[model samples]
Every structure is written in C-alpha cells, then in structure tokens.
Target: MSNNTNQAASDLQRNELPAKKPKKSKTLQQSDKKLPFLLLTPTFILLAAVTIFPILYALYVSVMNFDTFGNSSGFAGLKNYMDIFASSTFWNAIFITLLYTALAVSIEIFLGFNLALMVSKDGKAMTYLRWLLIIPMMLSPLVVAVVYLLMMNTDMGILNYMLQSIGLPKINFLGEPTTAFLSLIFVDVWQWMPMCFLIILAGLQALPRDPFEAAEIDGASKFQVVRFVTLPMLKPIIVVALVIRTMDALRTFDQVFVLTQGGPGRATETISFLMYRASMKNSDFGFASAGLFIVLIITIIISTMLIRFMNRSQSA
Candidate 1:
C-alpha cells in the first residue's frame, strides 16, 4: 500500500511538471516576434519628438502675437486668423495656387495618360523609353528649375533661339506676369508628368490581358475595347495619380522659388510661398503658424475627400 501511494504521487508530480521548452532557435524566433515592435519604438519616439512637437508648438504660437525671435509680446487670440482672412495678398496667393494646381495637374494627366498608353503598347522599345522618361523625375526639382531658368532666360536662352529659328517671335517667358505664370506651369508639368506616367503605366501593366484578348476575338474596335475595358480598370490608378499630382502641385515651392522666385509681381507666389515669406522673410511667427495650420487643415480635408471618393468609386 505504501509503494502504490508513492507510485501515484510520483505520477502526479510528473504530470504537473512543464513540458520541455522548444530548442534555442525556436525560443529565439518567439522572442524575435516582439523585437520588431521594440525596434520601432525608437522611430516612433523620434517622429513624435521632431514632427508632432513642432506642430503642437506651432498651434500654441499661432494664438499669440509672438515676434520673430519667438518672444511672446502679447496674446492675439484669433486676431492673427482674422487678419489672415482680411488680407487680399492671402486671397491672391490662394487663387494663384489653385490655378497653378489645376492647370499643371490637368496637363500632367492628359500627357501622362497618352504616354502610358504608348509605353504599354510598346515591347522592347519601352525599356529604353521608360528609363528616358524617368530621367526628369530622377533629377532634383531644384536642378530642373535651374536648367529651365537658363533655358527660359529672356536674353541668352536657347529656347528663344530655337523659337526664333522656327520663325516664332521670342516672348518674355519669365519677365511678364501672364507668361511667367504659364512658364511656371509648363515647368511643373514637364518635371512631374513622368511620375504620373510611370504610375499609370504600372497600373496598365498590372491589368490581366484576358479582357483585351477577349475583346479582340469578338472583333471589338480598339477604341471600343479601350473605352469598355481599359478605362474602367484604369480608373483607380488615374484617380491616385491625379490626387498625388494635385497635392504636389498645390504645395509647389521648389521650382517656383528657384526659377521665378514668385516674381513678375507676385503672380506665381503660392500659399507655400506666402508662408515662407511670413515665417522666414518677415518673421511673423504667429501669422505664419496660423497660415501653416490653415494649409494643413485644407490638405487634410482635400486628401480625406479624395480617399473617400476613390473608395466609393472602387466599391461601385
């Protein structure tokens, strides 16, 4: 009876003992699952430290009549915002930005769409063409601006020489207000159209070939096939390209800054340009903060609406 009791107790103890853990590699793999998050924590902290802090600080400063040195001389409440609304310069900047964005994005979409279609139809030829297309995009925007500025110079520009050679009279590309704004628009389109083309081309390539093949078999005209099959399938890509291009064009600063410097009587000065002037040139920290927040809010709202509209279109 004592032996039986001892044997039963031993069995129970063995049952209660934990199973041997997995080998070291397995143990390490389980540990590694948590390591990615641990690693990401530092990045998250850094982003919050750099980005979030400045944004919050800007909001706080916008309510105050702070001077250039960030010295809080007085509280302005909504006075800064009210003044911003009352300023005609602000309205002009807004209008110009909208106009530039509209024109640039429109031209980019049209040209990019055509370029993407042509590239998609080509075979080995497209490989070289694609690289060529990407060169403008790869070049720094500042570099592009400088190159175009030299080309568009009223006096010694090669562009004018070429136009004169072609029996076209040379017009002031950057010296006149209307021509300057149009020149800025043209430069923007030239620089950014490649990106739009690449994006749309990728989408075109991703499409299954069966629908087009079927249309071909059914004796569908090329136009009919494109209208029915290609356009519908490519809608999402088109929308994405439009949104991205629009956003970039709206905040257009680098090209305009380097090339025109918002010159010809502030004709090309965008909201971003105005913000830069307020913050850097004039050193009105409070007003700059308010303007920045306003721009940020507008961007968020526009992006949100675009996303929602795209989602609905995709679902439909």
Candidate 2:
C-alpha cells in the first residue's frame, strides 16, 4: 500500500511540472524581425511604380528635346527651362495662379468659419444643414464647372434672363477678363467653402469645453470668448484648411478648361492651364516637363512651410 501511494504521488508531480518551450531557430527569429518590412514591400513597390518612376521620367524628359510627334530628339540641356522662364506668359500664369489661390482660399476660410460658427449647435436642423452644405463638395469638379458654364451663358442664361427681367442690361460674365476671373473665384468659393466649413466645424466640435466654460465663469461676452479663446485654438485647423485649399487652388485645371480655356487673352491662365497648353496644344513636352518640375518645387516648399507652422502651433 505504501509503494502504490508513493507511485501515485510521483505521477502527480511529473504531470504538474511545466513543459519546456522549444527554442526558435535563428532564421525564424530574423524573419520575425523583418516581417513588418516584408508586409510593406507591396506598398513600397506600388509607390515606386506610380510616383517615383513618373517623377524620374519627367526629370529625364525635362532635359531632352522632344519632337512635335512626341519622339525624343537629342539632349537639349537647360534650354527648355530657360525658354519657359524667359516667357512672359509663364510669369503671368504664375501670378494668376497665386492670385487665384490667395483669393479663393481666403474667402473660403472666412465664409466657412462663419458658417461653421453659425451651425455649431446640437440639433437635427444643424445636422441636416451640414449634410446639405457638404453636397456641393461631393459633386465632381468638372461637373460643377459645366453646370456653371451653362448658367453663366450671357445670351439666354438664367442669370442674364433674371437681370433682363429686372430691367438691367445683360452683363457678360465670362466674356470679360475681370468678371471672368471673379466669376471663377465665385465658383471655386461656392464648391470648396463647404470643405473648409466641414473641417472647421469638426475642429470646433472637437475643442475642449473647459476653456469656454472658464470664459463663461469669468463673465466674458460671446465676442470676447471667441476672439480670445476660440480663434487661438482654431488657428491650427484653419491653417490646415488653408493648406489644402491652397494646394488644390494652385492646380485648378478643370474649371479653366471648361469655362475659360485660358481665354480673355490669358487673363485667367493658371500654371496648370499653361502646362496643358504647352504639352497638348504646342506639343512641347520638354517645356511642359520643366514647368511641371518648377511647380512641383514650389508646391513642396509651400507645403513644407505650412506643415512646419502646423507643427509649431500644435507644440505650442
């Protein structure tokens, strides 16, 4: 009986002992360390194919002369870039692009902030209005341009018809230079203001209630609260909105294509439209590529500055 009891106790102790883990091989450990990079290989390959390859090709083409038939004709060195830089049209396009970006982004930011402030409340009506406001941005830019093109037609368009009905002379909206530029700005503001509004409204919603509550406790008026507390906190978000709109406005092509086609003697010719004309109209691919590189450099600089500002604001 004592031997059987001792045998049972030894069996229980053996069963209760922890099992030893098998050691991983060196190769397996190395693979585990590299798994994240291996998983990202496909994404890196895709970026290389789409982005890096095109940029490199553009750089190559920018230095080489291309024939009218789109065949590479020999090395042209910096001739293409020099020609583009010397052209008055190129400078004009740059100025117009900058002007458009500044006006559109500023107006959009101003109107969007006000609209967001007006509707930043808890109600079904505000929710529905927000959805309605975002609908314009959801439409395709080309489609918006086409719609405005029809509406702005001078002879039989709705705007002119209304003006004539009110005993006013029909005003040429797109036929003139200043009106055409302003009209383009109006269209851009109409379509993109909602994006700014949505972004600012989201920022407003996400802002901490502590500051506002504190201001209220101190018996601050609404304007004082907004001026002191709201604007400072919302600066980063506004800058983000500005950066996005500025980049987009700088590359505006669809509206220029459909509405003006850089008409009224290049009054509204943006850099993007100029590039299109260089490549498609004049068959000067080298010039177009050089222009593209210049624009790319400018865009990179602007975006870097904006990003740095955003970082500083956040850190502060």
Candidate 3:
C-alpha cells in the first residue's frame, strides 16, 4: 500500500510540472517584448544628443546674433537670413553647387551604367574587376583629394608628365578657375560612380527572367526589350541612386577643401564650404546658422519629393 501511494504521488507531480510551463512562458514573452526597446534605448539617446540637440541649438542661434567671442547681441530676427540672401557670394555658391552636382551626377550615372553592363557578364576576370572598381568608392574624400592633387599638379605631376610624353601641353588643372571646377567634378565622378554601378548592377541582376524570356520569344530585340521593359522596371532603383548621389554631391566639402580651398578664386566654392567658412573662419555663427537652416529646409523638401516619387514608382 505505501509503494502504491508513492507511485500515485509521483504521477501527480509529473502532471503539475507541465502546468507550471505557462507561468514560465508568460515571463519570457514579457521579456521578449521589452528586449528590442531595451536594445534601442542607448542608440536613441546618443542620436538625440548628437543630431537633434545640435539642430535645435542651431535654430536658436540662427535667430540671434552670435559671434565666436561668446557675445550674444540679442535677437537679430531675420536680418541674418536677409543678409545671406542678399550676398552675391551666397548666390554664386548656390549656382556653383547646383552646377557641380548636376555635372558630376549625370556623368557618373552614364559611365556607371556602362561599367555595370561590362561587368554584369559571368566570368572570373569581370567579377575581380568589379571589386577593383569599388575600391575608389571606399576611399575617404580627404585621401582622394590628396592623391589626385599629387597626380594632377601642374609642374611635376604624373598626369602632366604623361601629357608631355604624348606631345601635349601640361594643363593647370587646379589653377585656372574653370579647370579647377571641372577637376573637382572629375574627382567626384571617379569616386562615386562605382556606387551607381553597384546599385544598377544589383537591379539588373534581380530583373525577372520570365519577362526577358517572354520578350525573346516574342522576337523583341535586346535594345527594344531594355528600352520598354528593363528601363521601366529599373526606374525606381535609378531614382533612389540619383537622389542619394545628388544629396551627397550637394554636401561636397572635404575634397574641395583640401584640394582647392574654394579657390583659384571661389571657382569650386560650394554651399557647404560657404557655411563652413562663415562659421569657422569668419566667426559669424548667426549668419552661418541661418544659411545652414536654409540648406536644411531645401534638403528636407527635396528628399520628401524624391521619396514620394520612389514610393509611387515602386507601387506602380
């Protein structure tokens, strides 16, 4: 009888163990819900401090007259903004920035597409060359500036040496204002075109095989299929790439800063470089902040429009 009772008690204990699992799982589920937020907390706080706080502070500074001497001459209202708008230098910088952005991005997109086409073929050599092309995009703008400057310098640079070897005159690339602007555009294209190539290549590779197969069966030529089907399908990716490259081009500074310092007489001066000079060199924080705010607003508006366009294309 005692052995029978022991066996019955052991069976009851085993049944109760299963019942306890619900309570344990409830605790785990609660922890799972909190885990993502807990993990994200530090990143959110850091971004708030670094990005959000600075932007807000700049807004406040934009409203007041702030000199680097820590002298806050009360509120200047929109005077700083008005002054910036009235300045020819500001307008010229804006023009230069737009022109540089357009030239660099357009040329890069065209060249990158061709490069992507070349490397899209299946082969070991082409695959290796694709990665080699990517190396330029991975380099920092400052490093690129230094390297290009060394190579393109008028007197004793390798490029001029090559020119002389070919019975051509040495060009003053960074000295003449026009050539300086063109040189900056060239460097930008060389560095960023790889990005456009990679994106377009990915889009090309992911295109639906069935559509191409159908087109081939329908006796559509390669160029016709690309024009009607592939390009339409690729519109969204192209837009995204162009928008990203355009924004980055607008923010050009480091390479230009090191290479020309906005010279051969402000030829390569961009909007970003203008703000940097105003804040750091001229010590006019208020004016700089106003200019920065204008840039921020324009960027926000343009980004919104581009994003909307991308969304529409994706949906279609």
Candidate 4:
C-alpha cells in the first residue's frame, strides 16, 4: 500500500505543467517605444512647414523696408513697427475691431441664450427648427455679406421695400457711418447667433438630471433654477463658445471686406481688413507684416488668458 501511494504522488508531480514566462525581449520594447514617435513625426513635420515657416517668414518681413515697385530694400530694424504705431489709422482699426467684437459677441450670447432656452425641449418641431436655424451657419461668410448687400441696396432692396410698404422711412443701412456700423453688427448677429444657440442648447440638454430634481424638491422657481443651477452648469460651455467666437471676431475680414471694402469712410474697417489693404491694395508688405504681427501677439495673449480661465473654471 505504501509503495502504491508513492507511485501515485510521483505520477501527479510529473504531470503538472510549468508556468509560462512573460515576453521581455529588448527588440519588442524598443519597437513599442518608437511606434508613437514614428506615428507623430509626419504630423509634427507638416505643422512646422505650414504654420511655423509662415510665421517666421512674416516676422522677418516685418522688420524690413520695401523700395518703390514693391521690393524689399533692406532691414529697417523696427521702423515699420514704429511707423504703424504712430499712425492714427492703426489705432482706429484696433478700436473698431474691439467695438465690433464686444457688440457682436454680447448680442449673440444674449439672444442665443434666450433662443436656446426657448428651444431646448426635445420635440420633432425643435429638431426641424434647429435645422432652419443652422442654415446661416452653413452659408459662407462672404455669401452672407453679398446677400445682405443686395437686401440693403438703396434703390430696389427688399428691406427698404418692406419699410416703404409699412409707411416707415427707408434707412440707408450701408451708406452711412453710424448705420453702417450698426448694419455690420446686425448682419454679424444674423449669421453667427445660431452657433451660440446650438452650443448653449447642447449644454442645456447635457445637464445632469439630479441637480434639477434637487432644485424642484427645494421648490426653486423656474427663474431661480435657470439663474443658479443652469447658468452655473453651463459656464464651461459658455466659456468655450466665447473663446472661439472672440478669436474669430478679432480677425473679422471676409464679410466686411466683401460688403463694405472698409468703406463708408473706414466705419467697418477691422484690423484684418486694414492688413489686407496694406498688403494687397497698397502693396506694402512690410507695414502689413508689422501690423499683423502685433495682432498675432495680442491674439496669443488673449488666447492664453482664455485658456487659463478655462483651467481655473474646471478646477473650481
């Protein structure tokens, strides 16, 4: 019996399998480390060529002088920047750009939030209405400007016709300074309010159900719920929308260029339009580069501040 037991134990020990070892070869490890870098190399090279190269070239151009017939004379050592800084037109362009940004962004945010609140409920009607609202966003900015130009024409315009039919005086929307500025603002609002509306509406819809339930249990009023709970929750989305819109607003040129050509006496001339005129119309690349570099610097600072603000909001 003892001999039989020992024989069974020996057979069991002989049949058991050994544990497998993990693969730890140096070649496999090296390939794994190189894979991500190899994948990123193409993207990195493209960015350097497209973005970095142009910026560096522009910086180089900004400090040079242009001779008659539009050739670079030589390095001017910040003279172009000094000249641009001393010019009143540059300051006016800056002021107009700021004014345009403030008014357009403010109106869009206000009207968009209200519109979002109105259409936030889930329904087939809302879905169709959303499609309608996004139509302007789908249209090109230049196309929108051209359409508005036709609509606001003095002799045979639809808006003037409607006013005349209603016994109201026809307003020259694009031919005067005050009205032209207002017209630009109204046009910009018409084109971009939908973007703000869509963003805010999405934010409203994605709101967590628990908070609203708690608010209801606490018997919070509708206004209170929106003011305290909804707005607080929507802050991050609002900041994101604002940053995007603000950056685009700072570089507004396409619509204004196609519509006004910075006309009606520079009323709607933004910094971007000013740059276009300097480089393309006037054939002064040095001046344009200097002014645009300043704009680029300001844009960088503003973008940094907005990113920092977003980080703080996330942390809070």
C-alpha lDDT score of every prediction, in listed order: 0.88, 0.91, 0.88, 0.88
Runs in model 1 deviating more than 4 A are 1-37, 68-70
Among the numbered candidates, top lDDT falls to 2
Q: Write the per-residue lDDT of candidate 4 for residues 1-316, one digit (tens) a residue.
A: 9999999986665566342222335567888999999999999999999989999998999999986567999889999999999988898999999999989998998899988888787577579879998899888899999999999998898999999999999999889998988898899999999999989988888889899999999999999999999998999988878888888888888888877888789888999999999988888999988998888888899899989998877677
Superposed Cα deviation of residue 290, candidate 3 (Å): 1.0
lDDT tens digits, residue span 142-209, model 3: 99999999999998799899999999998998999999999999999989998998898888888778
Candidate 2 collision pairs: none
The digit string of per-residue lDDT tens for model 2 on 1-316 reads: 9999999986776677664222335567778999989999999999999989999999999999999988999999999999988989988999999999999999999999988888887667569978799799999999999999999999878989999999999889899999999999999999999999999999999999999999999999999998999999999899899888988998999999999999889999999999999999989999999988888888899889888988888777
Question: Candidate 4 clashing pairs?
Answer: none
Best by TM-score: 4
**Candidate 3 regions off by >4 Å?**
1-35, 68-70
For each candidate, give its TM-score against the true structure.
0.87, 0.89, 0.86, 0.90
Candidate 4 global lDDT:
0.88
lDDT of 1 at 2: 98
Which window of 10 residues has the lowest lDDT sum in candidate 2? 17-26
| Decoy 4 TM-score against native | 0.90
Candidate 2 ranges with C-alpha deviation above 4 Å? 1-32
Q: Alpha-carbon error at 295 in model 1, in Å?
A: 0.5
lDDT tens digits, residue span 240-312, model 1:
8988888788889998788777888889899988889888888898888988888888889988988887887
Candidate structures ordered by TM-score, highest first = 4, 2, 1, 3
RMSD in angstroms between candidate 4 and the native structure over all alpha carbons? 6.9
By lDDT, the better pick of 2 and 4 is 2
